[model samples]
Target: MSPPKTYLITGTTSGMGLALVKHLLSQSQNVIATGRDIVSRFPREIVAAHEENLRLLELDITADVDTLQEIAREAWGLFPGGVDVLFNNAGMSAVKACEEASEEYIQQIYTVNLFGPMRLTTAFLPLLRQKTTTTTASSTVIAFTSSSAAWTPLPFMAHYASSKAALSAYLESLAKEVNPPPFRISVVGFECGGCVTNLGQPRQHKQQQQPQSGGSGGLLAKQQEEKTVYGDGLGKLVGMFTRDAMAYMPGDADKMARAMVGVIERVGKQGGGKVPVRLVLGSDAWESVKQKVEETQQVLEEWKEVSWGTDREGVRGGAEGDYLRAVSIL
Candidate 1:
């Protein structure tokens, strides 16, 4: 059997984060679960049973960069060695039309979903690298719970989709800079499907409730909106996420968490094999991404002439050539 791995996961108060903590513990892996109030908030049963393997830390991903670095230092001291995996799983979603999304709302979404994770990743890299450099037999991985919304747009989710898309793109760029030997940091993003978690809860819940469940973060929706052109359409959108309605969604949080764990373990075993750039979970996520890819291909084929016409004729040159050559692509 593969040996237990140390995982430091963020946003562990509930939803995908909590489920992942439960799943990893069941596998006898060492887990450093973090959230806003993880010590008192983590389930007592699991904590008591796995006291030797589990450690709880209070981490608010949206904190300032310096605070995040301090927390990373504290987390580094919890376990005996380097963290085997760092799951940047904390995220929040906003549900509003482009016109109705307040600047504050938009900023909150970006802070929690994109900027926060980026800062945390920066804070934790030194520790992850330390582990990799010292243990030639081990590999360190960083994973994100990115969403299928990144590729498949959904109504009332512009901010959410855009933020996730930006995060995924950033990870692609980061992988290129960090995946070298001596510090073999593997970066992956999972484009997960919708699941029955607090993530779909309306804005009221976000303001009124405490974090305690398995969800990316509670869904965001204003309780009241001034009359607007969207009218009935907006009403229908809000109605679709009522607690009863969300319960009917096909994806299961536990199942999604289990799938994520399985994929991470499988790839970790591959050693130097090419790490997956993005992985989609759930049947719905699969279909949505597949359709998006097909549509993108069609658009590219039809726009091929316009695309090529914009570029200068003959071989690439100037700064572009210099960049390509510097990167060894030419």
Candidate 2:
């Protein structure tokens, strides 16, 4: 049998990151997992148990650029041979309204969700390139954990959504720039639906209270409040979100790990083909993507006649179109 492919994943201490790590390890695949609080969050015995396939690295992706670069260098040194996949799964979400959200909160969210992943991907590209060079048949992939919020606007989460939007845009440009011969870059925008993850916890806001798990009735009440205030028809969305946040999603970490592994395997067999630029992970995300696309299409269609002119000169160049051009210029 061939050797197992190696993966390097960030934010492995909790939520999707932790789930991905557990899943990868169970497959007997090699994984280098990084997180801000690995030592504190994971039990020593549990970590030690996967010694053969797991390497825990402490990295706060939201750290200063220089510090993050240093961490990347250290990680590169640790995996001297290079990694097959660099999964940028570490991120944070802000629950406060944009106006109420502090600058610090906004900056922190952007740093973790956008800048950190971009820097890490830049640092690791050389190694991934090297792997592709040596093993002519293999390919390297860079995956990002984006959100459905990137597609649809969410009240009280504008900062989080904007940061993800920036990341998505950057990855789209980066994919175009990195196109070359046998070496290829695949960016998976994992637009996750509400999973049972720690994302719902309002960590960035100062006044928000911690979530409590009480009796079934209390949980039901909380769900009701979330729906009434947040939006209606959110039952399924909330269920998935609760499951992800609570670590109760079907098969929990295993399911996520297997899904990721399957994606990588499929990418590999396609002759180093790229993973879809977008991977809407759950049903909620699919609906959101569909709705957003349809809305955009509708808006464009409604204004098509006004947007399109009979001729280029008629639209902007001639004196007859100077007013239109001037308005357009603004």
Candidate 3:
């Protein structure tokens, strides 16, 4: 008999995470769900309905290492053998200029979006590393819910964008670290585009309050100064992108969640499993990322000579002919 497939997801309280939980449970797969204040807001009836396969554990992701260790112990008890996937779906955003973000707010964003996932992933290493390679199950995947904003830098939400960019780079390095034989773990990043979720709005509602659950720091939106050098232009650009562009975004949260599950299923199929490190979802995400790549490449090419000249003679236009495949200014 095939081993029961189990998925562990964080930030399961709302939005894509909530949708993902329902979708996985409906498929008769075992799911371990976690988030802050699980009892107060979550509907426990759903877990009761799927008692055998669903387990709910409340976790404060921004908590200390001891707290994370406790949560990992609880999670292991639920699935003692191992976990098939660790979906790091939790993230936070702050609608403020980089300079406008407080030390507290920046720390909060990185804590939930970046550090929290790292802590949990590290804590679950034993269970994750126990994944068997011979099985038909796809390579054990540790996925992160990244943002398209990572590619396109916006003036207001610089922290969120940079955090995600760092996440992608970190995951890429992790992919190289864990793959190619003995270690079967695979790292995949989901660059989810705008969906119909209250992701950025709550930060606005709880601006005055201390940073807590999914603190978006929307309160800082008020800091956009119309008189600042590029203030008006930045405001219009951000407004049009966030409001007008999102108004017509094609992807739905639930649908995206389902599609993600489908992709996971394909990982260890009959054909050798293939999990692309970066999965960019939605038409809007594809277009925006593509534009950013093109723009960057164009800028790089325009300054190729000056940029490449910094390399020592042996490294650049060296006698050994450009230190192997080292790029040179034509």
C-alpha RMSD of each candidate structure in angstroms? 3.9, 7.7, 5.0
Model 2, position 50, has a per-residue lDDT of 88
The 0-to-1 C-alpha lDDT of every candidate, in the order given, reads 0.76, 0.64, 0.71
lDDT of 2 by residue, 99-148 (tens): 55567777777787888889888777776676676676464678777766
Question: For this target, which candidate reaches the highest lDDT against the unseen true structure?
Answer: 1
Candidate 1 residue 45 C-alpha distance from true site, Å = 2.5
Off by over 4 Å in 2: 134-137, 202-254, 270-274, 309-330
Ranking by TM-score: 1, 3, 2
Provide the lDDT at 286 for model 2: 73
The parts of candidate 1 lying over 4 Å away from their true place are 201-229, 236-248, 270-274, 313-330
Rank list by lDDT? 1, 3, 2
Best by TM-score: 1
lDDT of 1 at 76: 80
Model 2 quality (TM-score): 0.77
Superposed Cα deviation of residue 305, candidate 2 (Å)? 1.9
User: Candidate 2 or 3, higher TM-score?
Assistant: 3
lDDT of 2 at 184: 65
Q: Against the hidden reference, what TM-scores do the models get? A: 0.86, 0.77, 0.83
